[model samples]
Target: MKYKKYLSILVISVLIVSCAKNPFTGKSTMALVPNSQILPMAFQQYDQFLSENNVVTGTAQANMVKNVGQKISSAAERWLTANGYAGYLKDYRWEYNLVQDETVNAWCMPGGKIVFYTGIMPIAQDEAGVAAIMGHEVAHALANHGQQRMSASQIQQVAAVGLAVGTAGSENAAIYNQAFGVGSNVLGMLPFSRSHESEADKIGLTLMAIAGYDPLIGARLWERMSQQGGDAPQEFLSTHPANQTRIDNIVKWAPDARAVARKFGVTSFKN
Candidate 1:
């Protein structure tokens, strides 16, 4: 019976790992959570978050946030449709908000709930900078990085549980505990977080270019971000890639993104 249970888990894990594809790169991906389960939950949580937060209203910045979001969302739609994935965003409830906050950060949750903190405005420097950030956040959602991370986490939990169960009666309890700690901390979290950041950077550039925002500006945005270093670790040591690495990758990938944009009649973008 125990062997049967383990076999079932192994089969389920294999199935979960097989059921994903990278939206931007068209690569096979590992995701355990189905979109049907993740999307509705993401939409509900986004709505609840907006209702709870002090979202800015009737302000120029807030309006710009919405405008940029709409542009990027449209760009994503066009790309998806052109790539034979039309209606891919049908379940996405896109919403953009400029929140009253002092943190120099921005993010988009799955299902297209985006928030721009007021403090990041200075770093944004202009409409293009805002677009750059918006594109990146939207890319994270489009690629379903959050869902992938969540799924990976679930797998990690399963592995940990299996380990604990298998060693419950063993004399190597301390070894098992140590292995679980190391596996969950290193194998489960850090690398997954880093991969999400890098994927977002790549997909974000494509989205920004498709939306008529210069993809090259992505590197400049990160340079400015690097200068505003606070208590936060340099991007390299954190979950994100280092500023230099990100800039280099953006510079390298911008031309390809522009080629993609050109297919959609975006030959040039605002500097």
Candidate 2:
């Protein structure tokens, strides 16, 4: 029975590791939640959020959010289709809304439900800037960052349970506690969030470029964001990287993004 349990654990670990892959970067990633299960939940939660929030109605900014979403969604579809992932978004109910919030934030849910805060508009400055933020948020969804996070959380929970079980009658209780603390610290946060941010930046830049928006403008958007005072915290203290780091990275990667965009006949951006 003990051997069977160990074998089962090994097999499950291998399967979990095999199931995840970074679609844009082509890297072997770790995802515990599958899209088949996550998407419906995300869509339902998104609907709930929209119903509860004050969504802008019939305004030009609201319409622009929808328009930008459609363009980015189309670009995602084309990219996925060309990469032999046709019909990947068939179940996605793409919806974009501008919310009346002072927070400068935007995010895309798993099924393509996107929300942009009104406060972000000034920083976005123009259509291209909006596209840059939208593209980044949409890239997070396309990359399944949320699902990966959920999966990681699950694994952490299982590991915690396993540790408790293994250390249940042990003389080395202190060692077990210390180990658990360290494991929890590493597993619960930090590295995974950073990875998601990086992936979003790369995929978002590519998406914006493919949507005929200048990828270079992504840097400008971040620079403006850094200038916003008061409630906004310093760059290093935030979940996102420093503004200068992001700007430099975007500038460095813009050429590659443009090259990728050219494959989709988006050789230039509208000035």
Candidate 3:
């Protein structure tokens, strides 16, 4: 009993110590691994990933990708500085690449390493579409979702261990582990991931608007995404929100996003 109490206190202490505020969301998030350590590793892995892929270069599509990336990144920097988080992105070495692949996906690694797969370009359609995707990817990095995810996983593991230790003498120990495995994933990790996706959608919309892209295009882009039509995991089991959900959110939040951009003197947006 004493051991269990100590373990509980330790877990709580670690969570408290590792919490940090996300400037964009103004909410506390776990940061078990500091950016000081994660950034270098992320950069190294990004370089390795680039070396392994066929990076598109000197093409119009490639140029478009780079241009949109820069616009979104600059907008993010402006927002950060204005929000009193100046120098927040100083350590981020931004690199954007278009890779020749048919995955219909794009991702931004920690510290601003971004890649747009060729397959997604067709879906993106134009610079405005690209801005929508770029904004979301950049928002993920700015919000430190990756770091928070890792921290959450670490805490989940610790909790699992604590559960096992606490239930060591139970005849239903195996059953307890089985239940926890399902419950933790459904109740804990999945919600964390889904919330991140939703938050990214809202942030991305505002950033793209501030970067002079029409926020309404975000919904249209997702409409195209939904038309791509593939089997998707159920929303409750998936890490990302459903495409329709995202599309609806973008539409619903367009006016608010534009209002935010107006505060930064960005009233005009591209068609």
Candidate 4:
């Protein structure tokens, strides 16, 4: 009982001290690890990834990746600055790379390292589609989703250790630990990830709109994605919002995105 009390206090203390504000969501979030430590490691890993992959350069597709990344990132900056968070991205070293992989994936790592897989380009079909994808990927970075994910995992591990210690000498200690492992992942972590994805979708829509791309294309892109016909796990067990849910959200959020873009003098949206 004393161990459990101490564990609870420790968790509470850590939670209070490890919180950082998410600019996009305006929510206090766990940030167990600081960016100073995480960014260097992320940059190194990103560099290593580029070295290991077939990085396409000087091609039209490569240029497009760079171009869309720039526009989306600039839009993010404009929004931040207008909102009085100027210099918020000073530490971010933005780099966009096109990789020769046939996977319909694009991701932005911490501190603005982005990679777009070749297979997604055909699905994008045009520069506007590319901007939608780019805005989404960049939104993940801008919103610090990577940092939050790492922090959540860190807390989960620490809590697991606390549970193990608190359950020590109990007759059902092993059973308790096993249950915690499964419960924490399914109940805590998966939901955290899915929330981040949804938040990214919202912020990305605003970004693409401010960058002069039609935010509705995020849904159109996903409509094509849904037609790709692969078996996916149930939404409750998945890290991303279900396809139809995302489409509905994008459709619903389009008017709000345009309203935001209008604040930045962007009245025209590309089709």
Candidate 5:
């Protein structure tokens, strides 16, 4: 019981002390790891990953990736500047690459490093589709989801250690430890990840709209992905929201996105 009390105090202290505000969401998020440290590591890893993979260059598709990245990132900056957060992305080193891989995926790392797999291009079909994906990926970086994810993982690891220590010498110590691992992952980590995805979806839609792409494009892209025919994990066990859930969220949020874009003199959308 004493060990549990100390563990709880330690966790609470860390949570209170190590938080950063997410400009996009206007929410305070966990940031146990500082970006000053995370950015250099991210830059190095991005360079290494590019070196190890077949990075496509000198192609129209590659140019589109660069263009879309720039547009979405610029839109993000515009929003920030309009909202009195000028230079918020000063430390971000934005770079985009298209790699020759068949995985239908795209991701952005900490500090604005981004990659788009060649396989996802077909589903994207056009520039607007690309913008949708770009906006979402860039939103992840802008909102510092990577930092939150890392902080959450650190907390999870610490909690595991706490569980083990607190359960020491108990008859069901092993069982307690196993349950803690599974319960924390499913109940805490999974929900945390899903919330990030949804937040990204909302932010990305607004960004795409501000970048002059139709915000509804995000929902369309997901609809196409859903038709690609694969089973998604149950929502409770998945790190991302279900495909239908994402589509509905984007659709519901599209009008709001357009309204946001209008605040920046963007009255038209492109598809």
Candidate 6:
């Protein structure tokens, strides 16, 4: 009993000490793995992924990807600088690429590596639409969602170990195991992921607006996404919010986004 108590205390201590502040969220987030380790691996993996894929170049759409990435990334830097975090992106080497795939997805790797699928372009439809998506993906990186996810997975593994030891001699061990797997996922991991998506939406809206893109474009982009996403799992069981939920959030938050941009002297926005 004493040993278990000490073990629990040590776990709590580690968790408390492993947190770092995310400037975008103004919250202390888990960082069990440091960026020094994560960034290099991300850069290497990004290079490898591009090498393995058919990356598009020299096209108008490709140019647009790079252009919007620059604008949004610049917007992030400007926000940081104005708010007293001048060198926040010194470690971030921004790169954007367009890949020829029909996956209808775009993602940003840790440290500013981004890829946009050709499949998502039709849905994006214009520069403002692309800014909406770019801002969201960039927010994920700025908020360190990748690092937090890795830390969360580590905590999940630790919990599994504790459960294994606790149930070693129990008659209900199998039932406990099954319940732990499902219960932990539904109660902890899934909600955690959903929150990240929602947070990215809010931060992305602000970033796009600051970059002189209309925040309303975010909702329209998602309406298109919903048409593409015929059916999504229920919110409780899924990693992302439902499309309607996301759209509602964007609609409610658009004015707030514009307010943020107004501080940065952005008086007009592109639709």
Please name the candidate that would achieve the greatest lDDT relative to the true structure: 6
Best by TM-score: 5
lDDT of 2 by residue, 117-181 (tens): 99899889788989999999999888878877777667666655555555666788579768877
- Candidate 4 global Cα RMSD: 1.6
lDDT of 5 by residue, 1-271 (tens): 7377548855775765587888899998988889998999999999999999999998999999999999999999999998999999999999999999999999999889999999999999999999999999998988899999998888777777777777788899899889988999899999999999999999999999999999999999999999999788999999999999999999899999999999899988999
Best-to-worst lDDT order: 6, 5, 3, 4, 1, 2
Which portions of model 1 show Cα errors greater than 4 Å? 1-12, 15-18, 231-237
Candidate 5 stretches greater than 4 Å from native: 5-17
- Model 2 CA deviation exceeding 4 Å by range: 1-18, 169-179, 182-188, 229-238
Q: Is candidate 1 or candidate 6 better by lDDT?
A: 6
TM-score of each: 0.90, 0.86, 0.95, 0.95, 0.96, 0.96
Which lDDT values do the candidates have, in the order given? 0.84, 0.81, 0.91, 0.89, 0.92, 0.93
Task: Report the candidate with higher TM-score, 4 versus 5.
Answer: 5
Q: What tens-digit string does per-residue lDDT give for candidate 3 at 16-50? A: 65878998899988899899999999999999999
| Model 6 C-alpha lDDT per residue in residues 10-61, reported as the tens digit of each score | 4774756588888899999999889999999999999999999999999999
Q: In every candidate, how many clashes are there? A: 0, 1, 0, 0, 0, 0
TM-score of 2: 0.86
lDDT of 1 by residue, 81-100 (tens): 99989988898888989989
Any idea how many clashes model 6 has? Answer: 0
Give the CA lDDT, 0 to 100, for residue 215 in model 6: 95
- Report the C-alpha lDDT of model 4 over 1-271, residue by residue, as the tens digit: 7377548956685855577887888998777778999889989999999999999999999999999899999999999999999999999999999999999999999899999999999989889899988888888888788888887777777777788778788899899889988888788888888888888999999999999999999999999989999899899888888999999999999999999999999979998
Once fitted onto the true fold, the runs of candidate 3 whose alpha carbons sit more than 4 angstroms away are 2-16
Q: What's the residue-level lDDT of 133 in candidate 1? A: 98
